[model samples]
Target chain A: MNWLAVKLPVLVTLGGIFAVLLIASLTVHLLQRRSPGKSYGELRSRVRSWWVMVGVFSLAMVLNRNISLVFFAFMSFLALKEYFSLIPTRRADRRVLFWAYLAIPLQYYWVAQAWYGMFIIFIPVYAFLFLPMRMVTIGETRDFLKAAGTIHWGLMTLVFSLSHLAFLLVLPGAEDKAAGGPGLVLFLVLLTESNDVAQYVWGKSLGRRKIIPKVSPNKTWAGFLGGVATTTALAVGLAPWLTPMDLEHAAMAGLLIGISGFVGDVVVSALKRDLGVKDSGALIPGHGGVLDRIDSLTYTAPLFFHFIRYLYF
Target chain B: MVRLLRFLFFAVLVRLVVLVVLGLNVRRREWLPKAGPALIAANHNSHLDTLVLMSLLPLEMLPRLRPVAAMDYFLGNRLLAWFALHIIGIIPLSRRPQRGSDPLAGCAEALERGDILLLFPEGSRGEPERLARFKTGIAHLTERFPQVPVTPVFLHGLGKALPKGEGLLVPFFCDVFVGEALHWEGDRAGFMAGLERATARLADEGRFPSWD
Candidate 1:
């Protein structure tokens, strides 16, 4: 009687997702074994946790239309926290950073409420003024320039950059779709994270030439090219389900995220080097920390969000 | 609340600026035995000495290490005074040589409370590259609080970082050398001699320029 409830479409989508994740996990596991110098044994547990995160997010996407925006908003907050912790900011900047933290909820709320015009100005123009004014009021007069610089940089990197994810969710025409934003969240998540995972995998396998010797020693030409290619292929395959695009558009999106993610990783790495810290914190298991995982997303999320908004919205 | 805010504000400012300019070099840091009263007898080098030590130690250990600062100097400016009293939790000592207002009493109280007090035995800023004579106040401190182990500390390059009577901060690498705690028997003369030996040892260690 309820055979329709478990239709081919639902079963097929679920089965396909399970199979993909299973294969990815197994590949990473085997990759770990083959690799001589591994980062940590706890990496296996982290990969398992990633599987759980993907599974839960995928289920949430299918179950509700509104939840996807909330999901990405939470992810943005974690990423931003990781960012601020790793980057060194002065005391005079704390008040401004407190205000910047306020931006997280407001930006996400704009997405949840579907308010477009406000989120746009909230970071660029409004935060720009408010932060500097905060520093000026402190009356230290000495080191005022440094204070201002710290505030502005922290705001731009953590709040303004992360607001893009929310921007993606509220991208018009994404509403009332059967695919529930047409698997846009899933597509973005997969491409960004897969770029990271694939790069690490390939780099470990055959990474002889260092891409940027100073910034990230582990990053290699082999890893970068391999990751971009594999992610592009995945994007092409998932295009029909995720977007109203053919293979070409998906490939372009993957490329955009892949390149931007690489830049993001380098930028955050530079910050870590400046602070003389290895990991932002030891909050995550195999991954260095939340910052290590989301370094790519800090740049990629906003870039991809804007690209989608411009082309499709 | 204003004072607390100011203290936090200045602390963060110094931490941030130092992070950029000097660059922290905390390779291996360890706290002393957590249970007992301890005295960290450091040399008076520069303004950056306290900051260097604070940054080097883990936050868990920071609350216990109270840097002893002069009430007249640190408390002279209202902002610095607030930071010293509230944020840094420095044990304030009067520079005026009055006897009743025993500066070491505060250190004793802190020790009784099971807190670690950082005392600069040189009493005032000296050429950090050279060891200044051990001030009598530490001898007096040990004679009174004989139970607490006097930990000798020497700060290298802090004089270059923020030299004596300097307004501008000099950017340079500084090292905070913490020697093993000095053992004190119940005898006062023995404790004083032990403190001197520990101080000399730390000064010698500071003389060795950091390879880093």
Candidate 2:
């Protein structure tokens, strides 16, 4: 193992995360020093939680490839578990759920083995067919359509989509093949997360026109545009160090992450609205749940992975 | 020896596996008394219902919690009977009437001894999403031991986790909503109906919330 090659990107990513957190803390504290409202405390706690998240992620990246794979796999497990907990299923779909849970490990194992063909289609094609087949064999036809749909949606969002992060780590190319996989994963996560924050910040500062008031009242056009602009600039600036892509492709990737991240966030909001819950779970102190934190990645990871694969690989 | 084994098997192993596998998210746990002689009455959905309830309680209460399981089902097999008897310490109540023994007698004795007993007032597992008419057995016990508080617990999604007659267990999320405890007022039918209503209210809470 080339220790310096791995350590360089990992250290740079960690340093970047520290600088962002420090600046965010200072800015939020300054903005709220005069009239500290609920947002002040919330932003403080959110920054605190980000420290833990960044620490753990950096540790995983620095350790080994397998460790990072397992970390992402565990993340998918938590997200899927939260999804299932929120959604209602018919009794007939019980056995089918087992099959759904089983897909997480099998999908990640393919990523570990670098089997791209199986990784891409395992959940969508195979699990989709197998889940309904398992439900049909149970002989409880009542609400069969709803049951199968719920499980398939969960598998798609939680396992199949999230697996793209791990898949990105295994892509074969000149740069990505040279242990640049972790850097790409870090780059994608950093841009997506920063975009989410930029939207929230800009939305609160200058947001007027609601984008979709019914589904998510907090989302606004100002937030969307500001977030896209900021994230696109960051993507281009950090492309050389953190990703295999150049300025133009990195800018494209930025737009994709920004837009899809908003979509994923709103989609999860819609789900919570339908289910009538505030947050998915209370695992994270400020983030509400693992799902709440990673909702944007559900879309960005898969989309960015494919984009990278198509262009570079 | 039995206590240690029960802690190891039921409290530690079974609870961890069940919580992870079923993805159980227990709500309104504050309704469950931290330490008291309360009768926990929940709607039966699957074999996992009891396990889910047990997993949610404080570990200290596990040894004292005696889930009233069906003698014909849990105790029919020797291995299961041993585990239920020794590890889970279930108070087996035979559905079939014996020659002279009263099924409620064991429950009353456990309550008198200050053990928290989990009773499925529905008598047997019913179809998922449907609550069977609760039998008078809970009413009888509550009447006999009026001091014991009957807390209504509604289990949602266990049926989908391990429904009746399913050999394999499914990994689904199950929510346990704990409601307020009811003290008997010397009315059997009214008390039973009130318990059922309380459980149904919790079911609604689990299915949908008043606010998003």
Candidate 3:
């Protein structure tokens, strides 16, 4: 058995997360009591939901490696499901949606095999080509272009991009400084999620200028910069035990996740606006749906993976 | 023993499918009664409707929950009849009531036992996700017992998933909207209209993946 992967740093990193969640819970509870209204009530539920989300995530990480892969694949499935439910598809593409879903496991299989080449191109190159070809065979010309673009885009955002998280689990380095791939996954997730929270808090407290008023009205320059700085500092602090990156490189990775996380988030916001919905669905209480929670990760995972891959590997 | 089988099959197996494989997005679930002596009127599209509703409540409520289904169809043969009666606990309401016999008798008895009666007012499954004309049975039953709460539920995605003549279960996310519980509005036409209006409101709430 390899003792390197399952060691003390994993526990320490998890403990640190738990401590931060505890403070958040207590703070939110206090805020709710001090100023009980709709917003604070929502904040309370959001914090409560965080506990369950983190609990499930931590359990998956501590389990067998295959379990970890399955967990990520399941998340991909949920995000894809939410995306499909929200969008309107042509009658012809409905059957093609099944093929899109079937690709989830095949995409994850590449991750499990540690075949980076095939994993990178399976959805973008192969799925991109094959989905349209299958639709052509289905004999549907009406709205063919629109159908092809939306289906392939859904697969890329929900399955292909998110699969990078699982692929990080199979990546060959970070075994010594961090608790292998789980640590890197943890680092990316923790920084990204906390960045979201930090931005919300900063915007609510001191936001004066809207970053992208049309796309996401709630986003502010104050929040954006504040979140990036906080995440960068956090990354530098947490990189020693959870990542192989030194302080300088860790800060760079932090900037990458922070900026791309914002872009990913706003893109989902644009999607919801187009669909005329406040939230995607009601799967997660306080957090609209699986898609809502994983939107930022859809970008952060892939960008951070390649960043680490280029620098470390 | 059979009760245990039903409970395990639903609490474990059916719930696994509903929760993971087939996602369920329900609105206003608190409107459902924890105990029975109530009627749950929903639109039926697939056989999965019964299972999806069963999965919503706690498992202990299974014994008292009865779906008022067609007798000849659900209990056509010994094997299916046995499964329906023992495992599903459906009240066998004969679609064609015998002369001078009450079709609603079984349902009334189930309600008298403080059971939750799941009724499909549309009488039978129609096209998936499309509402069909509602039968007057629900109104007649409610008029006979005006006090019982009838929860109007609108189900989507199941019909698309496992509609009639379809064997493969498409894993589409189902939307269940539990409308405000209504009561008998004195007359059959008025009550039927109210039921239609309530279900229509719920149907509009769902963003169904229909090709327009």
Candidate 4:
């Protein structure tokens, strides 16, 4: 069997996850032993959920291409569901939502078929026109602008942005093909997730000036810069092994992911604030919801996918 | 055997559709009685409301939990009647009464036998987010069975998920707010008003405050 082709990266990623989990387990154990409060309880649960998330992700990647694509597609579906659940919509926009959901499989089908043109324009162009046209037929114009805008924005962020991760798996060429497309996905996920962790650690230790207290109270400039610096260094080190990028481009990708990751987090925060919700939903045990966990990726995935495509592909 | 079949179908198959397809999150489950005879009343917004409420009950309660569906609407066809009678175990209440037949008789018998009954006091599906005037049947039932507890349930987002006359089932996050069981000993008018007020409170709880 040619399973070794996929096995190496899976093993390496699993090893890295084990090391991180061990360190986190020790850290939480020690910190909570002294403090023992709500934050400690949340941290412990978050770490525990990470193990399950990592297991699901690894199994998808190891199984084959189809399973991995389906996994990410399902994630996009969930994130979109959460987004719609929280957002206000007019009674007229009901049918528009059906079309919006219909776009998920069509978009992912393009990814599966490796039809780049359709995948890129399906939501932005076709769905952009189609959703409004469909809403117009429903004959409710009271909240036309707001309703249409809300549906389009949801499709853009939840479906279009997240689909890029699945699209990454099908990028053509020898290097990515040899490395297995999952490596690129794993690379992006690892860096984005690490950036989140780094920011949290940095913010707790050194955060002073709030970046945007109105939007997200906890985010600070110190955490943002510290996370960017650390993530860039890791990206540069891991680029040769995982991605096809040179050191310079990898560093650039890291910087892009780190900054945009924060943007994604706060943007979702702004949405939640506007809607007056603490978390999107209680889907994930400690992470709040699927949207909370993948908020960073909503921005990073599309940007990084296009960046690599522009430079390397 | 039939009860077990109904339990498996609704608890497993129907619950899967409500949870996975509809993405409903039942809140304040503690408000629902774990067992016994209580009239579970909710505001009707869509056909999906009955299914969503049915999915929230404990599996063991399914055999005894009878959702009071309209005989004309759900039993319009033989196939639907069979599914409603056999699978859902509905106590089909006739909207328009025929001579010599009591619509409330069946419901009363079920409650008297210690079976939990789910009723939609709104009579039929109304517009999303707005409550229709509740019918007086609930007050009559509560008066007859004064010992039975009437729990008000407010369903949020089912109207949008599968509103009236919409064929497509759009997946949205729906919340089932099960409120405390209300008991009343007064005139039918007063009792009906109290039930309506209770449902309105649950509805307010379901809605996001204007500032929010």
The candidate maximizing DockQ is: 3
Give the lDDT ranking, best first. Answer: 3, 4, 2, 1
Greater-lDDT candidate between 2 and 4: 4
For candidate 1, give the DockQ.
Answer: 0.04
How do the residues B116-198 of candidate 2 rate in per-residue lDDT, one tens digit apiece? 99889888887754689898888988888888888999887666666677778766556778898899997999998899899
- Each candidate's interface RMSD (Å, one decimal) is 12.7, 6.1, 2.1, 4.3
How accurate locally is residue A167 in candidate 1, as Cα lDDT from 0 to 100?
62
Kindly state the fnat score of candidate 1: 0.00
Report lDDT (Cα) of residue B144, candidate 4.
90
Q: If you assessed candidate 4 against the hidden native complex, which CAPRI class would it receive?
A: acceptable
Which candidate, 1 or 3, would have the higher DockQ against the true structure?
3
Local accuracy of candidate 4 as per-residue lDDT tens digits, B55-91? 7777767778888989998889999998899988889
Alpha-carbon runs more than 4 Å astray in model 4: A1-5, A22-39, A174-178, B1-8, B98-102, B184-194, B207-212
For candidate 3, the per-residue lDDT at A159 reads 96
RMSD of each: 9.9, 3.9, 2.3, 3.0
Q: Indicate the worst ten consecutive residues by lDDT in candidate 4 chain A.
A: A173-182
Candidate 1 CAPRI classification by DockQ: incorrect
CA lDDT scores, all candidates in order: 0.67, 0.82, 0.87, 0.85
Local accuracy of candidate 1 as per-residue lDDT tens digits, A169-258? 556777544233535655776688888888888999999999999988899999998988888888787767766566778889888888
lDDT of 2: 0.82
Across A1-313, the per-residue lDDT of candidate 2 in tens digits comes to 5664364764776787899889988887888886765467776788889989988988887788899898999888888877876776564555566678889889999999999889888887999889888877888887778778877998899889998998877777634343388878888899989999999989999999999999999899999999999999998888877777878998999899999999999999999998988898866777888899999999999999989888988
Local lDDT at B49 for model 3: 97
* Share of native interface contacts recovered by each model: 0.00, 0.35, 0.57, 0.38
Which candidate, 2 or 4, would have the higher DockQ against the true structure?
4
Chain A TM-score of candidate 2 vs. true chain A: 0.93
> How much is B145 displaced in model 2, in angstroms?
3.1
